[model samples]
Target: MDYLLTEEQKMLKEMVAKFAKEEIAPVAREFEEKGIFPQEIVKKLGNLGLMGVAYPPEYNGAGMDNISYMIAIEEISRYCASTGVIVSAHSSLAVDPIYRFGTEEQKKKYLPALCSGERIGCFALTEPSSGSDAGSARTTAKLIGDKWVINGTKHFITNGEEAEVCVIFAHTDPSQKTKGISAFIVEKGTEGFRVGKHEKKLGINCTSTTELILEDCAIPKENILGDLNKGFKIAMVTLDGGRLGIASQALGIARAAIEDSIKFSKEREQFDQPICQFQAIQWMLANMNTEYEASWLLTYRGSLLKDKGLPYSKEAAMAKLKASETASFCADRAIQIHGGYGYTKEFDAERYLRDAKITEIYEGTNEIMRIVISAAMLK
Candidate 1:
C-alpha cells in the first residue's frame, strides 16, 4: 500500500501550515490567557474553506478528500488546539452527519451556512449521565401531534454556546434502549432550548464548550434526521469521522512540541555547549521524533482509508490512541527541555501540554480507543 501524500494533499498541507504560522501562532497565547473565543479568526478560517474541507463543493465546501481534511486539521492544531477543536467539531462531528443523512431540503437549509462558516454547528450527544455509555442517554424526544418535544440536558458540548445549529440525539422510546434513539436538527433560539453556563475546562479554553438544556423544546416532524430509531448508529458513524479529526489534532500537537523542543535544544547552552550536543537531550529528541513519525503514519493511513471508502473505524481508533498518547508524551518532554520556562505560559509548550491532555479525553478517550481496537481484533 502506498503511503505517500498526493500532490494536492501536499499543497493543502503547505497552505494550512503557512496560514497557521502567519495567522494563528501569533495570537494563540492571548486567546488562551483571556479564555476568549476568537470569532474573528474563526470567521476568517471559514472564508478560507477550512471549515468544511471535506464536504462537497455543491454544499459550499472545499470538496477536498479526507487526507486534505486531516492535513488542514493538523496544521491548524499545531498553532492552536482551541481553534482546531472549533473547526474539527463543526466539520467532522456536526456537519458530516447532516450531509450524509439529511434530506435534500435539510442540506439546502443548513449546509450552505455551515460550510461557509456564516453559522457554526455543534453535536450534542453526551449527557451528564451518559458519556461513554451513549446508549443510556436520558434525553427524550416525545411525539406530540405534528411535533416532537425534547427534554434533556447535554453536557460538555463543544461549540455549544456559539453554535447556530445543533445536531442532537434523544431517546424516543426508552424501552428500546439504543434502538429508541433519534437525531434532530435544533436551531439556536428555539423556545425551551437554552445554552447553559460555559464550562471551565482544563484545556482548549478558546473553544466554547457548554451544557445544552432542552426543556420541552419542540420541532416539526420534518426536522428529524435519518430514520426513526437510527440515531445511535448515526452518532457512532459520526464519531468515527470525528476520531480521525482528533487524531490529526493530536499529531499536530505532537509535531509542534517536537519542533519546539528541537529548536530549544539547539540554542540552549548547558555545560558550555548547546544542549542538543549532549547525548541525553539528543536521545529524548530521537525518541520524540520516532514516536511522532509513527503517530503521523497512523493518522494519515486512517485518513487515506477513509478517502478510499473503506472501513476506517479501527484505523481511526488506533490513530487516535497512538497520536494522543504521543502528543501528551511529547509535550511533557518539551516542558522538560525548556526547564522552568516550559511550565510558564511565556512559551507555547505549556499550552501544548494542556491541549494534548484533552485529546486523550475527548473523541473517545485513549481507553475507549483501546477497546475499539480490541473489539475489532475479535471481530
Candidate 2:
C-alpha cells in the first residue's frame, strides 16, 4: 500500500532525469531533423547500464526492480522517445524472454552481451500479416537434418536493421494454429537472413524499424528459445512486460508536454497578459495535469505487480491503453497552446504530437489493449 518510492528508487529517478536533461534533450531535435540513429548516445546509455536496468547483475544489468526500470524509461522518454524505445525494445521484448525462458546455456551465451549493450537485440513477432494476431504468424520453421530452416518476412521490427540478434517466432506446426508457434534465436548475417528495407516512420525516427526476410535461414536445434510449440505463450507473456515499458514511454511523453505547456503558458502573452490568466488555457492545463497523473498511477501499479511477481497482463494492458491515449491527448493540447509554432519543426510540440500518436499504435494498439482488458474482466 506504500505509494512513496524507496530511497534507491528515488536516486535512480534523479540519475535518469539528470542524464535525460543534460544528454538527451539537447540532441533530440537534431536527431529528429536529420533522421540520425544517434549511435554514440545509445552507446553512452549502454555504459550507464540504463540499457538493461531491470535485468539481473550477473547478466551485466543494474538488477533494479520493475519500478526503477519504468522510471528510467519515463525519464529518457521525456526528453527523447527514440532513445526510450531503443532501450525499451532491448530490455522488455528482447532480453526479458531470454532471462525468463532461455536455458542456462542460452543465458550464458547471449544475456551478458545483450545486457551490456555490446550487441543489440530485437524481437520479431509481427509479420506482414500478423500484428495483434500474433498467434496467426505465417513464418514457418522446419527441421531439416540438424538445423531448422526458416522462411518468412517480418515487418515493422523495431531495431531490426542495427540489431546483431533477433528473437524470432515461427510456426512449427501450422495445423496446431496458435500452439504451433516456436521461438528461436536468429543471428544476423546468417546464410539466408537479410535485412529488407528500413521504414521511414512518422516519429521516433532515430530507432530503426525495418523489414526482415528469412529465406531458408538455418539455425541449429539448440537455438530454440523454449520448448517447441510453446512460443505463443512466451510471446504473450513477454508482451505484458513490453506493454508496461510502452506505458512508461507514454507517461514520459505526457510529462514532458505538460511541463513544457505550463512553462510556456506562464510566459506566452495575449492581450498584454500571460496565457496563464486565461480560463480556457488554464482549464486545458488542468485537464492535462489530471490525466497525466492518472496515467502515472496506472503505469506504476503495473510495474508494482511485475516486481511482486504477480499476474500483470490486465494491469499492463490497462496502463498502456490509458497512458498512450492520455499522452496523445496531452500532446495535442500542448501543440494547441503553442499556437502556430506548434505546427512547425522549430518547437518540440509538433514532434511530441507525432511521437504520441505512435504510442497508441504500437505495443499492441489501444483497441487491442481494450480487448485484453475486457477479456481479463470476463474471465
Candidate 3:
C-alpha cells in the first residue's frame, strides 16, 4: 500500500506517525482515564498544518490530498482513539460541510480559525429521539426579522463540550420532513444556546460526547449553510467523508491491537516456550494482519475516489463497515492472546476492544452501512 501513496503523502505519514508516537502515546491512557481533551496536541497538529490536511492553503490548511488526511488520522488513532475522533469530527464532520457548501463569506470567516485550531467545531444532527433516522429529527427552526430562531437538543455530538462553532440541522417545515431540513452555523455564545449533559462513554472517554441544547437560539439569516430545505443532501454528502475518517480510525485501532499482540506472543511464556510457537496464537495473529490489510486497502480506495472527485458514498460505507468490524475482531483476539492480563486495566487490549465498538455504532451504524451499500447495488 505504500506504493499507492505519493512521495509527499508517504512523508506526511511518517511525520504524523512520529508525532503520534512521541506526543500522543505518552499521555493517551492518562487522558482517557481522566477524560481530558488533548488541547495542546490539537494545537500542535494545527501548527504543523495537519488539522486541515485535505483543504487548500488559502484556508490555512496543509493543501494535502485526502489520503494524507486519512494517514494523519490513522497515525494519531494508533496512539489515541479519542484524539483521532476529535480531529475527525472537527475536520470531516464540521469543516468539510462549510468548505463544500458554505458561501464565500462563510469560508473566509470560519475556515482560517477552524483550520488553524484557534477554534474547534462540531456537527450536531443526532438527538435524543433521532439516531439513524435523521429524517425524523424533531428540531425546528423559523425565520424571524433578520434572524433564524432555532430550537433543538442534539446529543452524542463529538467535540460538543469544547466546540466554538456548530453545524446544526433543523426542520424549516416539519410537514415536509427530510426535505424541509436545513443546516445552520451557530457560533458559541449565541443567545439561548448552551452545552448540556456530558456523557460517560465506555471508550473514547477523552472526547466530549455531550448534548447541545438550543432554546430559541437565534443567528443571522446569513448563517444558514448550503440552501434552505436542502440540508439532508448536505448531511448525507458530508457523512461520506466522515465515514472514511472513522474507517481510518478503525484501521489504526486494529493495527494497534495486531502490533501489541505480536509483541506479547513472543515474550509471554507458555509451557516452556513462547506462545507465538502455538498454532492457535499464530492463526489469530495471521487473521488479524490479513483483516487489517484488507480494511486498510478498502479505506484507501475510498480515499482515492474522494481525491479524484468521484461518487464514493458506497465505497465509504463498505470501508467503514469492514474496518470497524475488523477493529473489534483484532482487539478481541489481542485480548485473548494476552489472557488474563488483557482483561485487566494493566494492558490496553481491553481498551482497544471498548474503543472499537463505537466505530461500528457511530458515523452511521453497520446496519445503516448495509442499507447504504445494498441500496446502491439495488439502484
Candidate 4:
C-alpha cells in the first residue's frame, strides 16, 4: 500500500526503515540480553526528529501527521520491539496527553523538552490495584494552600526509571470515585517522588518497567492537567491515541516475524528440500502475510481517522485488538516454521513471541478493547 501514503509519509518510512536496519537491528539483541537501556539509540532518534514526529514545530516536534508517526514506529519495531515501544510510550502516552489536553502554560513548560527528547516522559496511571479499572486507583492528591500533595505507588510504568517528566493520576476527591481522579505533571526530582522496583520482564528488557512512589509529593496547584476532576475523560482520550502507537508497534513485530520466517524458510531444509517448498510451510506463510496486512490496514484507518479530527476511539480499539493478536500469531507461526531453532536464543523467533505477548496486555488489554468496540456499536 505504498500508493496510499503521501510522499512525506513515504519518505519518513524510508528514512526510519534505513535507520532501524543500520542502527537498531545489530544492537537490539545485545541490549536486550544485557537488559541495558538503548540510551544512545534513543538520543540519536531524538536528533532525527522522531521523538516528536507528530507534534508541532513550536514544541520542538517534527510536525508530521499520525500516519507518519505510525510508519516510524512500525519501521523501528521491525528491527527492535524494545526501541519501538520506547518511542511509542513516550510519544503516545506522555506527550499526547500534554499536547492535547494541557493548558498553554503546561504545554510551554513541558512540550519543548519532552518533544526534543532532552527529557524523557512517562504516564503513571496504573497502580498495584488498578489496571483496566483505572477509576479504582487509590492514589490520593490533596490541595493544600498553593500546592497539591500526592501519595501513592504506581507500578508497571514504562520509561519510569529515566523519565524526567511524569504525568501522574491521583484521586483528588475520593468520595466522587471516577470523577475524583485528576492528572498532574510531576518532575522526577520533586520532593518525595522517587523511582522504585524495576521489574524483570519476559521481553522488551532493554526498556524500563518500574514503580513510581509518591509520598506526599507536592507540585504547584497549576500542575493539574485538563479540568479539575475530569481526569477520567482525559485518560480515555489519551489512551485512544496511545492505542494507535501500540497497534503500530504490533504491526512492526508481526512484520519482523513474517519476514524472518520467509528468510529462514528458504535457508532451512527438510527432507532434502528447502522448508519453503513444503505445502504446509507455504500455507503458514500465506496466513501470516494475510493477517499482517489486515492488521496494518486497520491501524492505518485508525491513524487516518485521528488525523482527520474524527472520533477514532472504536477504530483505535479495533486496531489495537487485531494488531496485537496478529503479532502474537505471526510470531508463534514464525517459531513453528523455524522448528527447533526458533525455540533457542540463537534465533529471534522466541524473542519475537515474548515481545508480542505484551502488546496484547498493555495500553488496554484485548478484552478491554473488545468491550470498547462492542459498547460503541451497542450504544
| Candidate number achieving the greatest lDDT relative to the actual structure | 3
Q: Which stretches of candidate 4 lie over 4 Å from their true place?
A: none
Cand. 4 Cα-lDDT: 0.95
Candidate 1: lDDT of 221?
A: 90
> Which of candidates 2 and 3 reaches a greater lDDT?
3
The lDDT for every candidate, in the order shown, is: 0.92, 0.91, 0.95, 0.95
Residue-level lDDT of model 4, residues 147-245, one tens digit each, is 999999999999999999999999999998789999999999999999999999999989999999999999999999998899988889999999999
Question: Model 3 residue 318 lDDT?
Answer: 98
Model 1 C-alpha RMSD to native = 1.3
Q: How close is every model to the real structure, measured as TM-score?
A: 0.98, 0.98, 0.99, 0.99
C-alpha lDDT (0 to 100) for residue 270 of candidate 3: 79
For model 2, name the residue pairs that clash.
none
Residues 157-214, candidate 1, lDDT per residue (tens digit)? 9999899899999999899889999999999999999999789977899988899999
- lDDT for each residue of candidate 2 in 275-370, tens digit (9 for 90 to 100): 889999999999999998888999999999999999999999999999999999999999999888778887889888888999999989989999
Please list the Cα RMSD from the true structure of every candidate, rounded to 1 decimal place: 1.3, 1.3, 0.6, 0.7
Report the Cα lDDT for residue 140, model 3: 94
**Candidate 2 local Cα displacement, residue 236, angstroms:** 0.4
| Count: clashes, candidate 4 | 0
Give me the runs in candidate 1 sitting further than 4 Å from their true place: 1-3
Model 1 lDDT, full chain set: 0.92
